[model samples]
Target: MATIQANDYLIKVDEPWTEFSKFVQSHHYSKIVILVDENTRKYCYNRVKGQLPFDHQIIEIKSGEDQKSISTCEFVWSQLLNNDCDRKSLVINMGGGVIGDLGGFCAASYMRGIDFIQIPTTLLSQVDASVGGKLGVDLKHFKNMVGVFKNPKMVWIQTEFLDSLPANELRSGYAEVVKHCLIADKKQWEEISKYDDLSQINQWTNIVVDSIKIKNKIVGADPFESGLRKILNFGHTLGHALESQLLETENRLLHGEAVAQGMILESMHSVNHGKLSQIEFEEIKSYIELIFGKLEKQRLDINDLIYISKKDKKNFAGAIKISTIDKIGSCIYDFNISPDEIKSLFSQSNFN
Candidate 1:
């Protein structure tokens, strides 16, 4: 098992085919249940299933953000019940973020927590979502509203699976890579910006290693998210709110796209406050736009923005804290800005 160490955690990166067998041989798991989505079942299930050393049951959920809810969890729990899944049975989350999050939740709640392995298929899952151990489902239009930080037994990243991902999904995962670079590594940021195509396996491997290292460093320092971990939400506050709102509409924005726009506006906020130079701010915006394209404005009510902002997890003692950039590779947190100031930044963002 190839290993990457995080604070109090070790991510075991294994070849997809050998991952299940390795887990079964090493651990005394009673049974294995592989959780997949429609997309993964079509593109990845056979390859994964063929490699398992033992006969394992499969649980497939429909593909889409709408499936990321408590109702879906109920369905999965029912499946587990019908299949006689117990605490000793292992759950292998074999898809992207949605499957990983929902499956992890199911496993965590089943018999008060069971071991689960993350077999992340998409680039986004491989690099960011699967590593942090933040598992949850959305509630009342909020993203990751109900969750827990339960680490997976192992995380198997198959770079080869990325070949089946849609181009937009590839672009979506790039945002987190960009976020990692912006928050910590200048060299990494430069390398990612310079490399255009993600289809190259060698390039992707390097990117994944660097991104995981950056995230692991931050998560190690603040596993409980009491301090430094808050910095990781730099673009996510407005980004996630915007994403939550937009997800309800017909014109949906991917998570990375929303975060890309969030980074732009947050950087703009930084510039307005004189915390970041105008040149630095503009460069950040330009680079994101170049890769993810410009953010298209949706007809969202100002009140909705307020409502969603209030739902942000970072609000402490009734004050919303934001993470902003003073420059690339550097971040600041706990900056209390007024709601009106946030609105003003949103208006001036020119997201269209």
Candidate 2:
């Protein structure tokens, strides 16, 4: 088992087929429940279930970003209650970010919190969503508005499972990997830049492990998202707002895509503030654009940007706290900027 120690939490990574049963045996829970989405149920459930101890209950939810809502949590909570799942019962989140987020939220709330494990199957969940232990659901189309900060007992990452992910999802997840490198590890940035394929499991293990270490180190210092943890939101502020705004559109961007665009725009902001050198800012944009492709500039309604920015969780005292880059592997948070400035940045070319 590969273990990452994040302050009080320990994330255990194991081979999903053989090692999961061993984890269960060691814990010796009274009951085991597996949470999955329709897609995971069809593709990954049997492969995982076949390796589990017998007689475990299974709960399934409808798949997609639309399902990561309070209503889904209600359904999951009902299923857990119907199963008589107590605090001692263990819940296994057996899908990507949505499953891990909603399932962890359910486990954390049920009976005032229960033990739950994350079996993150997608690259995005493995590197970003699953390890951080940030759990929440969407509220009225705003992303992750109603959520909690709760760590899981363990997180099992099986790169073998990436085989079933769609190409777009894989690309979306790789964006986080890039973000990880940009925030703290220049060596990792160089390494990931050399690879174009994300399906290589062997190569991915080290990348995932390194990314987890960077996040764990940061989260260890600020587990409750007090100050330093906010750095992890490097590209998320505008990215999330844009992602939320585009969620209902046919050309909806994935989380990583939104974040990729966020990184570019925020890097530009960093340059504008004189925190980052023009060369450094351009380097960041160049690499992201190389991998993510050119940002597709759209005429976003400035009023909508202000509306979403106002609703951002990071907003305090009626001021928006934005994150900007100082240099490679370094970031600063709580930097305030005006809506006109943001609109000016958005109007510029190459900031998709």
CA RMSD of each candidate after superposition: 2.4, 2.3
* Best lDDT among the predictions, by candidate number: 1
RMSD of 1: 2.4
Writing each residue's lDDT as its tens digit, candidate 1 over 167-217 gives: 889889988989988888888787777755555444466677788888888
- Candidate 2 wrongly placed segments (more than 4 Å): 14-17, 196-202
Report the alpha-carbon TM-score of model 1 versus the true structure. Answer: 0.91
Off by over 4 Å in 1: 7-9, 14-16, 197-202, 297-303
Error of 2 at 16 (Å): 6.8
Q: Which residue window of length 10 is worst by lDDT in model 2?
A: 195-204
Question: How high a TM-score does candidate 2 get?
Answer: 0.91
Candidate 1 local distance difference test against the native: 0.82
